[model samples]
Target chain A: MARVRERAKMRSTVRAGSGAAARGPRTLYDKIWDAHVVRDYDDGSSLIFVDRHLVHEVSSAQAFEGLRRAGRTVRRPDLTLAMPDHNLPTTARTGADGRRLPVADPQSAAQLDALARNVAATAIPYFDATAPEQGIVHVVGPEQGFTLPGSVLACGDSHTAAHGALGALGIGIGTSEVEHVLATQTLRLNRSRAMAVRVDGTPGFGVAPKDVILAIIARIGASGGIGHVIEYRGSTFDAMSVEGRLTVANMSIEAGARAGLFAPDERVFAYLKGRPMAPSGAEWDAALAQWRTLRSDPGARFDKSVAIDATAIAPSVTWGTSPQHVVPITGRVPSPDSFADPVQREAAARSLEYMALLPGQRMEDVAIENIFIGSCTNSRIEDLRAAAAVVRGRRVAAGVRQALVVPGSGLVRRQGEAEGLDRIFREAGFEWREPGCSACLGMNPDTVPAGERCASTANRNFMGRQGPGARTHLLSPAMAAAAAIRGRLTDVRTLMAEAGMGETQMGEAQMGETGA
Target chain B: MTLIRVEGRAYPLGRANVDTDMIIASEWLKTISREGLGKGAFAALRHDPANVFDDPAFAGAAILIAGENFGCGSSREHAAWAMADMGVRVVIAVSLSDIFASNAFKNGVLAVCLPADAVAHLLDAVRGGAGIAVDLEAQAVRCGGRTFAFAIDAFRRRCLMEGLDEIALTLADAEGIAAHEGRVAVDAPWLAMAGRRA
Candidate 1:
């Protein structure tokens, strides 16, 4: 009892003078990231103790293989969970030849097998492709309610920050770190200073969480928020649903911030209530009771503060290499001097060479060869609805090749298809495919042809990140769908206006209804 | 893992957004293990790969100079493992990406943070062929014979100097954990006995 009291007092003393101390509240991430600080180094970092470690096939295979060489077992198997996602084939109806897909390529097969062997050998809970609950790690973790508000979650995938939507201090780690977590369940981390980005105002029509994130990434250059943990607050966040919050947090890494978080709220509670792995009945009540306490004080301080009116955001799209190289669909390609920094200018120059775009070209004028509307970042049912609304009756542009829509999860796929979203896509010349990370990483057979330009909804467009020298223009699903029908980066608003869609309703339902 | 205070002043490399591929090209990805990564470190920077590192232009540059988000994308340990293997003691940057910074620390690569302005100043001096010294004990960096104080997270400093990783840190608490486990096993024998029910 005395020890508990002493620890509480110690925490209060330490919490003083930090940026998080500004509000009369504490953010769930602050509570979690700070609570797990095992020790502070003189270097201004902390050795954070990781509570739950999630591993995947692509990165964990090497680590477990290394452990075998060292004759070591997973040190804390109880705290670790394993799954395979990135390399899984997207076949709705599994057949014997299902394993022939590129995701099932020899390397990926070996990795999947090794992961199964290691997990079985170590007796850790695993969700393989065959597992009914299996999906993308980010999707599964939340669906299973394994990610809690006050825990630290680490995975080898960059989108691990997706878990931060639950108010967890989630960060993507490397293979060695996965090995380290498996062998110890603790991470030697350098603590990051917290930056509070308070977003106010109501979001505009057709603007989804993906657009908001893209807008933030554009404002704060890809690396502008580097080494900082962004705590998103304000009325805009307060109005968002749990799923919407997840989408915003998922792309935090795209802006170069180590992590992004929203304070836990009633929406968070309602989302986790009946989740498979969430605490049951009385346990649920207690969990909610505890989670209710997680929030930033009314006057928490911050290292930096950036505010933007959510109303200013539109259906944004990226015209260049990094996610930050973005602008609204109505905007034009930035001219040379628009990039004040020399490095950006050089990178932009090179990107222009590959993208084949003139400096002053309007974003809407640039044509696209392929259109991809899926990725863990923006492949949810809501995302599909947005795209469907635009493509419901509109035919794809004459020259468009392989226009595709891949849902992020099986549930999302089912929900979308049941609502006739698949019919909408197929009638409009879009290929309605199975749920998986299809063209997101080009790991599967779904890839952009070499030297061809594509408008993708997936995150990250580094040179050859999608394919060898494939020019990718990142955009919202609606934008991607609009481009598919127009064969160019056409503004979805103009397409909707022209299609005679949205005459009946003008708000949220219009987003759900057919645009054409 | 030896705590060798960076001796003498070395110039910052001053490259902006140096990616992992730039640090060690993908051609080097064929190798499975992280060892020998040092030999190929900075392979992309040199026009003639071998001559670049040995050239007097960057001779004895103990502290790497980099711009914001020094390491971005791809959570590859090879990136950090190679940088450590390349005899880089400290990576002085305006900022670092999360995964890269964590990898650097686990492998004993000290990532030092200075404001962007200070890094820009240091880069200017280094580009001029001025050397910089980073004293671990003094917690300061000296460039062109002028000393500038720097800060490090106290905990990471200890881990780097001691070469203690997560495994080692956990091992330090092994005895206590063992005792706790023993108690758990006695209190809830079924928990230990539980297995995959086929």
Candidate 2:
């Protein structure tokens, strides 16, 4: 009761400080929107300032070309960070003599060259392929503290939503929006309606953070987050480390959300404190005071609210093409008739046919030939450690043709190597590779073969996402490692029991200072 | 963007939750330019003999019709560019993804959302050799003696009819952006601290 009263006082204080005409109670989205809105248009859209921009290769080439076509320079080059990820090879980037090897794929080389030239021409900071900081844009942003609380961050890649885990308003944009941000440093856009997803109970043992998000997506369905920016709240997110929160938030796009966000807290402050780009000294103190206020007021209203029982979430995996077609690892593949709607039922039937599974087939009986334990979603040090725990003493199943572990960033790779995870994976017969979004989207040489099944930690399981006719079952890193061990979709609980490892052990991979 | 009205035989490929990856493959995205994406549009779907996107009757369709959550995944604008390159001027769906809608709008393609019944009705009409028309000026979709009204943001509607470059339009408000940056410098000076160069 006293806590409620304190929240009420805080709401009133927030209203008083905000220059807006005293909004009653504002959600975190509202507060961020109000702070960044530059000018409101007559059409109910506003030009909101973007504080940071991360530019990558695949979706940014046309955007830079657009800037050149219009003869416009980057409005705020300091606010922009550029790197190549989508097309770069995850294999060794340097040759035997330590000189950078030329990208084998001509198209990938051209795209990378375009990004390098664009960043060079505009004077925006860039990390080359061999740079320690070069990695997935979404992974690189928060690692360097380039993504901060209450700021708007835009990137051409959809996984830009990952930054929202740090309490920043991260928006994924198309090439056109990228061009707009490059030229104006502001997006002329309407604010997305707010949706809050609060998890109430504790996750059971063996249920990884990846399972939590997959469960949320399954519960909400594919388009549940359309036209909305979802806020991750409740005890679950509060307990989740920055890496875990990032894994969840990165996949929000798969739910069709404009972005996924969390309110800034002490954990966030500790994560950002002493980073390369984070403010230091007195400025850090000032930023901390302001960041502390970047939360939703009590009694704040959201356009939609979803509640999930965390205990109900099991180590989950997608049996079909879409992310929404997820089921617990212990469950059986469902029949299309199970869906009440004709459209969903039809889609299910098509997916089932494509996946070559019968309606009542046991998920564990479904054999997977490949395993991918990395992507923007589950490629952090913690994720790598979780997979390592499952693979520590075991060898990859003979039926499992290939299992690959690619870290999210170069630093994450080095961190995993430092912790001796590379040895565990390599000893388990898993290919421990460099970072660069390997086999996740199949843009590079590391593609899963057609007519094969893969248990991937990547967010999307869309048909042909891994490769044409490559069936992907999305699961947690531990679950993927378990699948690699079993050569089929198996429950991670039994494996966790075998390893005597609790889920809590997965959360121990610490990211101290970047340079430290 | 000059797309006030688009009248054509709507391609009846009404699959729900059509992802951008399904529309265009990742291999096709490694281009520095946006042109020549039509060949790769629905490349995966076209590999299936039963896929309706390659139906002879719907070849070079100026308007495409689909079910809800169309363009559900990925923020890649190549989906929109590919559709436009295929001569698609409008996409009518039960509902459209937010990023897809913005991308389509910026690339001179109209994304119109209507009720499921209306979309189903239009799909049936188009499959039966009837031409459908999306009139942005009237804010309505007309086909086979029936019309369905749609709601679109006025600014987006204006941008479609007038076809203004969005960057040029936003640059006109430079004063407003500068003013906001000035306020940030005073209120939160730490926010502007960028990382060191490599």
Candidate 3:
């Protein structure tokens, strides 16, 4: 019809110069955000289009039910992906045919069953527990290349900020917001301010990206990034691997930031070159050209700026419940009197009571009952290799209770096995488990028992997060491996030194390389 | 959503950094239904026999007064759902987490952020068994006949007053969204996939 032809012409005209015309110098977040804004309201809210929607089991059942109740279908089924991660048991046994056995917990089984039915009815692509690509929502997004640079992605899980490391504007949404996006492939949001967290100098020996982010959270406190989108910059982030960058961006939510991103470069392009969901042929060329331009201008302005010296950051570990209750590995537990803020002091006292620690107690002397080196935060291939390096010939201490090494994705698990990292961990008294959000939160069967203390690589350490009355101390993969070896919170640098592994030697270590 | 004008006895829950886990434990999230969450709203706190939620005087209170940074952990909307299920209409605190505040607004629960001193005064008065009142249109909270003005985003205020959810507001701009989607279909073909089977 004539009307259809007229609309086509109008769309072509709008497409000609919409995203190509450069208005002025702008931050990376601003450029991507402005390009995606469909409409701006008078109240400073905008309807922004979402390029990808990742859904998991724990928080998405209600959202899909909302859609069903409203008699609506997913507007963009092609863009939405689902997986059952939170409730998947890591220790699930397989039958003779290699199919996973039924989940033991009735509630967890029902959650997964609901997810399967929802995905089946909606026709959205899903990686079930038996699927090879099944993993944590955040991990699977990047592994499959569904998370692209210069894109806008969202999910119901809070750690969705992990995808922002690829230069995407990633955000966490509630069930209501998830329903909104499902019915219409857009979100009503108020733009967040831009913040720059610049990391200068090079990271020292045994210092990982996890340590840098934990140190940053400690410096800024939990609520410092309340309404901002942080951009991690400077040479330190530039030199980090894509996996390391993911680790840093994964914990941005702990700092209360909406998202965290890094400018796309060769590292990003290299990581996405032949990914399953990446572009190909001429589309790849065009995508690369556009992604190359997705960076902060030389003189872009930010609402707030924080500079951190990477060299000054040691192997950081959280001694209390909050992510901000962190200290260097060599430091002692903080006294309540050291806290000037009454709220912080009270929080410290409560955390101390829950953790059963005394003031001025040495951090290295704190014994741990469990060690969990897996989560969306640090369960990537690089993180596994780092832990493997520390536990190459070392044995888990006798006093320690249990140690779990869970991969982030099936692909990462396969890669680790190929590189013999799994064998190393198992030989060192760790249980190599299947990939899922195991032991991250207590949603699955893998949990720290009551009255136990764990050194975890997960982002959160809230009360009852892992299990009721279970205490958690957040640390990096290497630090967790060191703790498992010493039966206490020990510094990885000191362990490396004791093992005659120097800083220069670790610098030459590469992922998947044997005999480090 | 409904136009909320809460006037009832307020329960004093003066705890700083009260996270979502304390509000509603993860074990309670297994059910798809939002009902029955009131039974487990403050499961951990209720473990203590002396907790205020179980006290005879505050049995059916509709308002909760808490300390700073209430609802600081997790993006679980269950925290808000549980509060609403427990007949809590207003939560007065010094500060609220960004996600929790939005969740409370969408679920017909009003999260009021006042100055620390005002929250302290409200806490004291509520502990003394004073009835509290909150007016969305006036952006004010009154306790023991003393009114304290609070600040809220004008858009959120209008939404609360008009009982408008995001979907309703978004539907008002349906034509604009249609036009934008049409343009995006040509501008970025990759993002326009709706019916393409994966």
What's the TM-score of each model vs. the native? Answer: 0.84, 0.96, 0.94
Chain B TM-score for all candidates, comma-separated: 0.76, 0.95, 0.89
Across residues A213-284, which tens digit of lDDT does each residue of candidate 2 receive? 998899888899999999999877777789888988998888889999999888889988887888888888
Off by over 4 Å in 2: A1-22, A503-516
Q: Pick the candidate with the highest DockQ.
A: 2
| Docking quality tier of model 2 | medium
Instruction: Order the candidate numbers by DockQ, best to worst.
Output: 2, 3, 1
User: Please, what is the whole-model Cα lDDT of each candidate in the order they appear?
Assistant: 0.72, 0.87, 0.84
Docking outcome class, model 1: acceptable
For every prediction, compared with the true complex, DockQ reads: 0.27, 0.58, 0.45
lDDT, residue B135, candidate 1: 72
What are the root-mean-square deviations of the candidates from the true structure over C-alphas? Answer: 5.3, 4.9, 3.6
Error of 3 at A84 (Å): 0.6
Candidate 2: lDDT over CA atoms?
Answer: 0.87
lDDT of 3 by residue, A317-398 (tens): 8988888899999999999889897878888998899899999999999999999999999999888988888899999999
Interface RMSD for every prediction, one decimal?
5.7, 4.4, 3.0
In model 1, state the lDDT of residue A346.
76
